[model samples]
Target: MDMATTESTASTMSLASVTLEVADPEATHRFLTAFGVETYVRLRASQAPSTGFRGFTLALTVSRPATVDGFLDAAVNAGATVLKAAAKTLWGYGGVVQAPDGTIWKVATSAKKDTGPATREIDEVVLLLGVEDMKAGKQFYVDRGLPVAKSFGGKYTEFAAGDSSPVKLALYKRRGLAKDVGVPAEGAGSHRIVLGSTAESFTDPDGFAWEASTSSARP
Candidate 1:
């Protein structure tokens, strides 16, 4: 069977894989921050003209609060920067960490009301991107051959959840994402993030980088 046929059982518009470019592919790949996310790091120099967020957050939804706290501590000890400490809120327990590769990870537990029990390591992750125009962004992705699993009120959108892989994807307004991290609406000169696919390389409406490749699989 062809690649599409193999991935058909996965979610619609599902990602074949996600790749991150770092100075050291071996080191970064060993620096596993979460599971269910496939990564390939290669030695690449600065291609962007400026330094700002390329536009995405690696969001991890764990099964329990302990997993949230444990992953936070483990990540920090592994050299990740603590952007936010785990706290109790309507969204359960969650915190943010900036991994060495400059990727922002939002780790959260949906226990709501309580920290819940300690749990195992993370085994699921979903990619969340920021777009300047939700309407236009949605249209852009939809036109790019990604099936829309859900798009509502222009506030949030998600691609078909890839069935075999736990690495799902979604998008939100860039401004809101910046605000969420207490950053400016517009970042500095260039972007730092690149989203990979199995076909071709292109830039999204907000300038996020995406390159097409041969095949994508969960590791």
Candidate 2:
């Protein structure tokens, strides 16, 4: 690694937890619990004005196609709207769902077929943020001491999710991300999401806020 990368790696920040600000914490919490992902996200009551796409998504990566279907089915049964039905694609089988609180979630798996019975074992959880300028966004995180784990030019960037973090971090173009989740690219007002990390509180260029990991909020 070069001087800059070395510096970033040395001070890399770990995303501890993701908190979703919703109008009804009780309802959202219920949905999350029923969906079997209450442990992956925290919830807080907030009436912040927001409309249309939130420019972010929480993704779940499992081990098999059956696991993907299991999550999708549970999410839908718990009041999540299906944005995309689970189906096999070039890369894998996946689907998208919108929670009642307006959070988009994508469940996927690399395995094309099921090897055994369906399981709720989640391999990874990733937080994908959509930004207006990919280069600027990537630099913003890097400047904040987030080392890049993977980068596909300006198309996508994944940050190293330290073992301590609850979820991985990544960046994508605003429109592209919105389209991938089957939502309009346009949105306004608060992002309705908060990132908990060891870093000081600050807002990113895309308006995603990060708070010092002092709050009682835990998955």
Candidate 3:
């Protein structure tokens, strides 16, 4: 295959962290720590914390079906709510889980053809945002120097992240997203997601905040 661009030549947005506004940072901390998000926490600021499904996550792409099942099992033990049991899909084997903070996670094995044991659990993650306007939401990131890898008729769009990103990002229609999370569509606030960046902190069109990882950390 012809290499049009490398991760370097592709995009400039490499995520520094995936922040969530939550009801209990302590509970979130414990749940993520079990799954290996070494530095998850809540904000200690004059402003109150945000909670509920501001968005969700396209968590990891495992190597096999059993891996997805096993990882979800671990997530269940770690105070997660099973939104969907692991199973085979036209895309591949996948499932959904609600983290302690109500962050929905869609886990799948994209490399289903590869009959391998499995990669380490939670190898790669993608931040999935449910946007009121998918077109406007996608343009928001495109204007920020990020490129779109895939877009499906303003329904779903995936961004090609820079190499420094621990996980990629995507956007989906808010109503469709509620279905994916296996919950009724409800709640909106200042947004729980805080984008970890090296540049100046800001907010997205949907009110999600972006913070420089270094300056982002607060007690």
Instruction: Find the candidate with the highest TM-score and give its number.
Output: 2
Per-residue alpha-carbon lDDT of model 1 for 58-138, expressed as tens digits?
788887777787778877877788777888876577888777777678889787543466665565677878887888987
Q: Rank the candidates by lDDT, best first.
A: 2, 3, 1
- Clash pairs, candidate 1, are 10-163, 11-162, 11-163, 16-216, 50-189, 50-190, 198-213, 200-212
Q: Candidate 2 residues 142-214, lDDT tens each? A: 8888888887777788888876676899998899999988889999998999999887888999889999888
Q: In candidate 3, which residue ranges exceed 4 Å CA deviation? A: 1-14, 23-26, 39-52, 111-119
Off by over 4 Å in 2: 1-8
How well does candidate 1 score on lDDT at residue 87?
A: 85
State in Å the error of residue 137, model 1: 0.5
Question: Which wins on TM-score, candidate 1 or candidate 3?
Answer: 3
> Which residue pairs clash in candidate 2?
none
What's the lDDT for all of these models?
0.65, 0.88, 0.68
lDDT by residue for model 3 (1-219), tens: 223322212455556666666666666667776765544333432234445555555567777887787678778899889988877777788889887666677778865555767555566677777788987987777777777777777688777766655678878887788787677777655555577875667777777777777755442
**What is the TM-score (0 to 1) of candidate 3?**
0.80
TM-score of each model, in listed order: 0.78, 0.94, 0.80
RMSD of 3: 4.4
